[model samples]
Each structure stands twice: as C-alpha cells, then as structure tokens.
Target: MSARPRPLLLGAGTAIAVAVTLSGCTQKASSEDGAVSVTASDSVCEVSKTELPAGHVSLALENKGSKITEVYVLFPDGRIAAERENIGPGTKATLVTELKAGDYEIACKPGMKGDGIRQKIALTGKDTAAERSPESDAAVAAYRSYVLAQAEQTLPRAQAFADAVKAGDIEKAKGLYASSRIGWERTEPVAESFGDIDPKVDVREDGLEDGQDPTTDWTGWHRLEKALWQDKKIGDRERELADQLMTDLNAWVKKVGTAEITPTSMANGAKSLLDEVARNKVTGEEERYSHTDLIDFKANLEGARRSYDLLKPIAQKNDPALAKELGQRFASLTGQLDAYRTDDGADEDSYTYTSYDMVSEAERKELSDGVNALAEPLSKLAAAVAK
Candidate 1:
C-alpha cells in the first residue's frame, strides 16, 4: 500500500482508502444568556467554548440551517446524556441537564460521533470531579478477582445445564442453564483466557440448535439458553439430554481454566498499538497487522496459547488441536505478508496503518476463513469446558 491516497477516476474499479478519523472541521460556537446556540451543518457541530456557568444550566439547541440535525451531549467519560433527533432547521429544542466541569463533546450529527468537539458547559456547586470513585489499581485487581469468581461459578452452572439437558431433565437443566447465562455474562470481559471448551458457556457465541431442524439443535453438549429455558416444557427427555450435556461440559471445564491478565499490561499494549497507528504507514509485515497490528495479533495469540496451555493437563482437550490449526493458519498468513517488501530491502519505519490492498482478496479471505474455523472449535471448547 502506498503512503498517499490516490483518487481513482472513471470506472477502473478503484476506490480511495484512508482512515476516517482525519476528517477536517471548521465551525464556531454561539452563546447568549445561559443558553448556547450554533449554526449546525453536516460538516461540523459548532457550539460555544467558555465552559457553562458552574450550576444547573440548561442547553438550548437552535438549528438555523436548512437540513435536519441530531444534537447530543457527550460527557467527559464517554457517556451520552441527552440526545435529540431529526430536529428541523430553524427550530429550537431544550436539553435540560446538568454538566460537571471536565471535557464534553456536543454534536449535531451522528456522523461526527467520535469527533472531539467541545461545548464547554460548566456546572457550579460541587468541586467533585468524580461522580464515581477514581479508577485505582485496586479496583482493577478487584475486577480481575470478580472475573475469576464469575468464571468459576458460571462454568459449574453451565455444566449442570448441559448435564440436565442430556439427562432428559429438560426443566431442571433449562432453569440451571438460564441462571448460568447470567453467570457467563458477568465473565465475558475476561473471556480471552481459556480456549473454548473450558465449560463456561459464552453467551455471545454458542447456542442450542434453534432453527427448523430439531435433530441438528443441541447436537453438542450445549443448547440455546432460550430453547432450554423459555421454549421447552419440562420433561424426562430434557432431563436425560441435560445430564448427557453436563458430562461433556464438566470434562471440558476441568480441562481449561481461568483467564489471567497482568496489571498495567493491557494499557501498555494499547499504547504500543496507538504508536503504530499514529505512524499510519502501511507496508511489509506492517502491511498486515504487523507492528501495531502484529502486536495486537501477537497478544491475542499469546492469549490463545495460554488458553491452549491450560487445556494441556487434561485428556480429550480440544484446545491443543485448535492451537495447532491456528499455528498453520498463521503460517499461511506469512506468504501474504511478503507483498509489502519493497525492492530496496528497507521496510518503512513509519508504518502506522496497514492497507489490506497490498494483498489479494483470495489471500485475505483464506486467512480470515482460517481464523474463523479456528475460532469455531474454540467456541465449542469454551462452551463445553469453561470453568
């Protein structure tokens, strides 16, 4: 991929590629009395700058342009307070809310959602900069502790659910599985630790066969939560099936174990990635997700390796096989990365963003499909074994 964006003309089947964040904007803020106003346009959401007076100050959005606009108040912590949609131009709407001093983004268009535009509104009274307690290392530690707890609790529930379904205790298994889903949801943020099959039913991915095909549904130890809990009536078949499911699920969880993360590790990893994207140069190994891309991929692979390793101590571990498959897929990816090497034998140090155009579509698909296949088995493993 070249450093500069080349605009294609006519029908060469060409398209210009660039990061969407580099968009330009120029709009001014207007303020009158306690209310703030601005000329809204598609290009930018303009508003006043001197922070809102320290107190409960109401914001009135007056759209003077011709087109419809959406107004939103984004707090410093990335929480959206109030939003108005399809407000016609030459119309005024009031956003009755209070703002605390920090930083805020006021927007008139969803297109400019991440655009860091500020409508400095300051609320008076409390000098407290925090509505919630400040983030501490202890808090993060507690979160990790909570993840392990949730994982342990949910994995058993999931196993019980599977067993109940297999044992033909449909009602018992379904109720247990539904409760397990709540357990699984709590652990989702730390899911990368165990290769699938660890016995924790990942609510996001695995599901019981729910379509018109009855035989295909619940083929594996896991079944859809809704099917097990809400849809199916309690019966002996359900109990028997659930019991069978638990046998598989428990075995899997015992094989793979808890997810782990080092303190200050993830943040440092993110910074390394942003440093690369900041450079935005795409080439060589950097052409793909090498550098920042590679680091992220590497971290993910490390996570995969850990999960795979966790499964190593047990018999019938599905993760090792998946890990080996992933290794091969990664090897296949090396060839596609070769396209980025220039004739000069020098890889650009400024590699910030990788453009996929450097490789062929067939190659991209091949790698993507490989990753997907690897993930599918992992998902099963996690559902079957999560502990």
Candidate 2:
C-alpha cells in the first residue's frame, strides 16, 4: 500500500542442528552469555552486547517505540538467520537461533516499514558438535520434507490454473484459483526468496505496484482472479499475465527445491502463517474479488499446523504441557474453521468454504478469537523447541 513491492507489513535438510534460548520478561540491562538484550526506539536499535559466542543465542527484544516493529538477524550471505515481528510498543519477544561462527547483521524495522536500520554483529567461538541436538535435526528434516512436497505439488496445480486462464475458460479458472494458491500460501516464505517473482506471482490487488495504472501494472493471481471472476473472460492481456505466471511458477518450483529449512525457521514460518490469517484473511481484505479469503485462511492454517506438528516432538520433549496445549489449540482453531465448510464434498480437502461476505460479524469475531487463542500458545513453540 505504500510503494513498490508493497509495504513491509510483511536449509537444509539434514536435520540441521538448533538450540532454543530460554527467555522471560526482564528489565535488566546486562545480558548473559549466549543471550543479548535488544531495545528498539525512535530510529535506532540498541544491543546490550554485539559480540556473541557461536552456538545458540537468544535476543530479548523490547520495543520502546510507539509503533509496531520487527527485528531480524541477517546472515553474511544476506539470508535471514532469525526474525521476530509485531513487537508492539511496550511489548517484548524473544528470538533464538543457532549460528556457526560468522558475521551477521541485526536489523530493526520500526513501524514495520523499509529496510530496517542495520547493525553488524559477530559470532565468535569454535564449532561445537555437542550443540547439535538429535531432536532438532529430525524436526528440521521433517519440515524440509513437508516444504519440498508442497512445492512439488504446486507446479502441476499452477500449470493447470494457468492453462485454464490462457484458454479463456472462465469457470474452470475461477474454480482452480483458490486450490492453485494453496501450495503457494503453504510454502510462502520459501517462495518469497525468489525476489520479484513472489510479488509478480502472488501480490494482491491492493499490493499492485502502481494501483493507479491498473491496466499495465496490475498482475499476478489477483489480477487474473479479477479477470476471471469479474470480467468473466481472458483476452490478450489476461492471457499474457497467465503465461507470465506459469513462467514464474515454474521458476518457483525450481527455487523451492533448493530453499533452506531449519528448526528456527520452521517455528517462525508457523507463526508467520497465522500472522497472515490474522492480518488479512479474517478481515476480508485478501479476497476482494473472489470472496475466497477463507480458502487462503485454511491453507495458511494447514501450513502453520504442519510446521507445529513437525516441531511438536521436540517441543514436547522440552515442555510437555506446552506441546499438549498447542495441539488442543490447533484442534480448537481447526474446529472453528470446519464450520465454514460447504456440503460440496465429503473429503476435508475437497470441501468448499463459505464466502467471507456470508460470514456474520459475530462469526468473524469468533474466528478472530480462535486465532488469538491459538497464537498465544503457538507463539511460545519456537522457544520451547529451542530449550
């Protein structure tokens, strides 16, 4: 909504090792080894200690700014090592990560906009094999397999949707739209690593590069969604967009194959999926043209739940009660979502969802409450796994 690429509102495999930093509310200025305290104010980010021992490190971040902010640990290669979002004014959150000895940057984004103010930090220590946990490794492997499987499935679905659009088959394209987006929504974080392709393929209408010049600038699934659901036809322009989408999706399939996955990221990805549901899906802001936001919400919830499931064993090993609560919360949220199912199919995946417009205000509130309930405990999962 602000500018290009839209506003900032927004490895692998081996059972990669991870460690969780146990954190709690603390007003102390001093930090313990393997832990740092971060404070975000008007324009700058302050760290209690910039140098950390390589292994597991926890950042206890407190937002002192009036607006919501986010923090990120940028790896040397520019990949994000860890990040925590939506730390509102006066709120605190913890980020835990396992790092090999390397140079990295700490980024604090105030007001959740722009490239965040950056600060360099160093991890100085010897590589310790003892830091790697078997539980963490297995969790990472399960999540990587989940993500790779989702990406593999996305290709054929995207191709089918694109083919339908290119052929000017309105009804077929409309039906395939939501289903096609499921894979992308589930593995969105990985898809986003492809740079501009993510936006070109998935950016919503509100996120169009230049909303003023809709004819030339508007594109992606929402663009084609509008053409199929509203215009009811795909002409040269829509066809061209469809072709480009197929090209980008093909590229995404290739990219996803090599996308990195780790335990910390798996936990963060789960939280992010819920954030997507809360930020846009429940508000009816995502599916303006198709009224299909619930479809995306369901997909996102599935992604979040899948991530949690992969981390559950480790989370349970560390904190059994917390893991049990998380499972119950997910089930509760799923039950809430289940109410929206139409009788169009008997299978869970084949069931159709009611349009958001048809949902009453009370129902929406219930949905929001359900998400909040789930998020409260879901938020603790990453730390639980790490510990």
Each candidate: RMSD to true structure?
A: 26.0, 5.9
Clashing pairs in 2: 11-260, 11-261, 15-137, 20-386
Task: Write candidate 1's Cα lDDT for 1-387 as tens digits.
Answer: 112111111132323221112132233445556466644655555565434453233456666666666565544343344444445767775544334544445556522222333343333356332332233234335545544555466556567666665566665754454344433332322431232332223211222212324343233323344345345554554555455555544543453243223222222222222222222212223222112233223333333433333333321343455546545643543333434433342532112223345455575455455444444344333222221
Question: For each predicted model, how many residue pairs clash, with residues at least 3 apart or on different chains?
Answer: 60, 4
Q: Each candidate: what lDDT?
A: 0.39, 0.74
Best by lDDT: 2
After superposition, which runs of candidate 1 have C-alpha atoms over 4 Å from their true positions?
1-31, 65-67, 110-387
Q: Estimate each model's TM-score.
A: 0.27, 0.85
Per-residue CA lDDT of candidate 2, range 41-94, in tens?
Answer: 767687765566887678888899898888877654445567777789999888
Off by over 4 Å in 2: 1-34, 126-131, 193-196, 208-218, 230-233, 343-349
